[model samples]
Target: MIDIVTVDTPHPYPPRISAFTRPFWEALAEGRLLTTRSVATRALTFPPKPISPADWTTEVEWVELSGSGVLYSHTTIHAAPTAFVGDLPYRVAIIDLDEGIRLATRHIGEIAPVIGAPVDLVAVRHTDAVSFAARSRA
Candidate 1:
C-alpha cells in the first residue's frame, strides 16, 4: 500500500459565494459539512442547492453530513499547476458518501487509497479557509 499524504497550506483562491451557497461556505468555516435534501423528492445533494436539481419545483432543506463515504476512484498528480506546484504527487479522489452524494476531494490517510475503501471526511484548514480531505476508515 502506498502511504497517503497530507499538506498544510493556504488556500489560493476564494470561491464565488452566492446567497444560495453562502451557508455552505459558512458551515465549512466552522468545520461542519452541510448538504441539501429536496423538500419534494427527499434527495440529498452536496454544495447546498437552493432548489433540487432533480425536480425544479422542489425547494431544498439544509442537512448535515456524517462525513463518511467510500473511495470510488482516484489519481495521483505529478504534473504541477502553478498554484499547486508545491504539492506534487498529491492524490485526488472521488468519494461516494453514505448519504448517496458523490464528491471529489483530496485523499488523506495513513492507508493507501483503493477502490471501495471506506473513508471519512476531514477538514483541511487553510490560512483563512477550509477544504475537505478523505481518510481511510481502515
Candidate 2:
C-alpha cells in the first residue's frame, strides 16, 4: 500500500483555471483523470486541447484515463519553485499512463520509486489548487 503525506503549508502558486482547461480541473477535483483524444487519428494528448496535435483537426473529445501507469522517470528536487519551497526533496515523476500518454506528476510515496515501476494516480488538494501525484501501484 502507498502512503499519502500531509503538509501544513500550502502550495504557493495555485493553478490558473481557464475555460479551455476547466474539464481537466473538474476531473482532478473529483480524483479522476481527464484527457483528450483526436477523433480522426485517435491520438491521445494531455492538457486537453481543442485541436488534435497528431492531425490538424479540431475534432477532439474528452476521455477518462485509467490512472494506472508505469514510472518512466523521476527526479528529486531539493530546489523547488517558490510555491513548493516548503516541500524540499520532493519527487517529480514522469509516468506513462496506460492510455499511452505520458504525464509528469509528483510522486507521493515514502521511498524513492524505481524506473518502470507501476504507479497509480492520487489527487492532492492544496490551498489553491488540486494536483495529481503518482504512487506505487501495489
**What are the lDDT figures for the candidates, one per model?**
0.78, 0.80
Q: What lDDT tens digits, residue by residue, belong to model 1 across residues 1-138?
A: 112233466776546778888887777666678889888888887767877888874578988888888999999999967877777778999999888889998787678998998888876667656666888877
**lDDT winner among the candidates?**
2
TM-score of every candidate relative to the true structure: 0.86, 0.88
Per-residue C-alpha lDDT of model 2 across residues 1-90, encoded as one tens digit per residue: 112334455656667878988998887877777888899888999878988889978989998888888999998899987767877878
Candidate 1 runs further than 4 Å off:
1-8
Candidate 2 accuracy as lDDT: 0.80
Residue 44 C-alpha lDDT in model 2: 94
- Scored against the true structure, residue 128 in model 2 reaches a CA lDDT of 59
